[model samples]
Target chain A: MRIGDLAARTGVSVRSLRYYEEQGLLDSSRSPGGHRHYDEEGVDRVAYLQRLYAAGLSSQTILSLLPCLESPSAATSDSAFDRLVEERDKLVTHIAGLTRTLESLDELITLNRKRRAASVADPDSGEPGRTTQG
Target chain B: MRIGDLAARTGVSVRSLRYYEEQGLLDSSRSPGGHRHYDEEGVDRVAYLQRLYAAGLSSQTILSLLPCLESPSAATSDSAFDRLVEERDKLVTHIAGLTRTLESLDELITLNRKRRAASVADPDSGEPGRTTQG
Candidate 1:
């Protein structure tokens, strides 16, 4: 399939497909007309790349772990295995930070809700917002 | 204090601090020599910015939501309030995706561990990794 076809199937932009190719995170072959072509497995490969990218793995790190990611076993090189463990630990830390940020957002949301409720009760918004038991 | 002081205090790089200023997420004043300076509140503001960035907010989104981030109240502009809610939803989605990736990594780790254990038991590893007993 053409690059555009892969992009459409995966919902990833063609530009990003090109970037993944540039970063060596993806592969393609040139057609007779010099257009990029991908095999049927390209769909699954693109999705896998997206998952790793979403996991916050840098291209270099992803490249190192590619062998393990594509095929998991005890036969994976010691360095690749170590990289997998390290990346996993980093994900844990990032998730914790994001969770804290979510908590802060929730607090802000709650504060806003309470203030709105107070304003409604007091009619301090100045437009007679109160409804008489409607 | 200078940019370096804020960086040292927060452990964020000076370049990142400058980027935050350019993004309007951090405030600074210039002295007669045109050196950027931050006041005591700079420390807290940098930390706050770090939290927001960790939550995966883009600079533009952070800029729009700054008024509320600096001080949350019922009086925040309607647009900023809406942005705050929108950002919260995005964070939820991102956290969910990261959680899935973490699970995938855990599965890969378990697969490798199982492979290693099986290799040891079968002795096909050919190295006699197992001990007879102490």
Candidate 2:
């Protein structure tokens, strides 16, 4: 398949796939016309890279951890082990912060939604203050 | 409290606090000596801003959502409601991806730790291959 196809399947941008290729995180071959081509494995690899990037992992960190990710049961490099654990801890803290943010946003959203619902149900009072809140 | 004190209390930079003030997300008063001052409310406001930033909310998006955040029972603007829901959905998807990444990193870390532990227990074979696997 083509690079664009892989990007479509993974829901990642073509530019990002190219960036991953540049970072040595993704593999692609050249077609007869010199366009990039990928296989099914490339799709899974791009998805994995996307997750790591989503966790705010630097390309360098992902590179360090790739060995262990690829061969999980094999003897792993010390650097990879250390990076993995460090990233995991950082991610835990980040997730906690984001969860709190989500909760706060949820509260605000719920409050607004409830207000809209209540006002919409009271047509007499709502008619005067109508303003596309729903 | 002084701006520096607020920074210290909130674990945020004076520059960031000033930016938040500029964005109207935070409030501060200038003293006779031309120093910015804040109260306990500043601390909480900074914390809230930090959480929103952590969840990848832009200053503009936060500005749009601030009305309901400040006065939960007040009628929310339509723009605020829309932006809040949009940002909430984005954060939800982002958190899911990061959680998956964290789990993957955990698996890799555990695999490497097990390999190291196993190699160390078999020191007769490990001594010859010892190279900081732990």
Candidate 3:
């Protein structure tokens, strides 16, 4: 498949695909006409790259882990396992932070709902806000 | 306060602070000698910007939503609320995606652990892998 088709299939931009190739996370052989050609497994490889990128791994880190992930049957080094554990820990932290943000957003949404409800309930009182005049 | 001080206090890089200023998410004044200067309130504003960025809102979206977040007591337009709701939905999606990734990572870790345990249990059998020879 051509690079364009791979990009279209993966929903990743051509520029990003090129960057992934440059970063050594992806590979594409050049055809006789010098056009980039991807193998049949390119789609799965791109998807895997997307997952690792989405998990907040840097290109460098992904480059290191890509081989290990691709060949799960192969004996993985302790360092690779450590890096995976580190990445898992980072994901845990990101999830926790996002959960806190979600909680705050929920509180804000609830507050807004109550304020809107108050506005509807007391149309005469232009100021039915929670903040009391000090 | 100088940009360095703000960077140190906020834990955001000086380069990023400048980028945020360029993106209109932050503001700073230049001194007589042309050094960047931040007010006392700049710290809080930068922290707020950090939270929004961490929530995965782009700088453009942050610029639009910053005013409403800064003034929660003031009247927020319906569109602002809609944008906030949209951002909240995005955050939810991101959290869900990360959660799924975390589950996969956990599974990989478990599989690796099991492989290691099996290898220990069967020292004579060089091939303790899950993959069966076809």
Q: Root-mean-square deviation of each candidate, in angstroms?
A: 7.6, 5.8, 5.0
Please give, for residues A1-134, the per-residue lDDT of candidate 3 as tens digits.
99999999999999999999999988889999989999878887887678778878899998776544654432666677678778889999988988887777766666665665666666544433441101
Off by over 4 Å in 2: A31-34, A113-134, B32-34, B118-134
Q: For residues A1-134, what per-residue lDDT tens digits would candidate 1 score against the true structure?
A: 99999999999999999999999888899988889999988888888788888888888998998766655555567799789889999999999989988988887777666666776677545322221110
Candidate 1, residue B53: lDDT: 75
Go through the candidates in order and give each one's DockQ: 0.27, 0.33, 0.25
| Candidate 3 runs further than 4 Å off | A29-31, A121-134, B1-9, B13-46, B121-134
Per-residue lDDT over B9-123 for candidate 1, one digit per residue giving the tens place of the 0 to 100 score: 9999999999988887777999999999999888877787788877878899889987566545455677998898999999999999889889888877776666667766775
Q: Which candidate leads the pack in DockQ? A: 2
DockQ (model 2, Cα)? 0.33
Most accurate candidate by TM-score: 1
Q: Which wins on TM-score, candidate 2 or candidate 3?
A: 2
Residue pairs in collision within model 2: none
TM-score of each: 0.82, 0.81, 0.75
Which order, best to worst by TM-score?
A: 1, 2, 3
Q: Looking at candidate 2, what is the lDDT of residue B103?
A: 77
The lDDT for every candidate, in the order shown, is 0.78, 0.75, 0.74
Order candidates by DockQ, high to low. 2, 1, 3
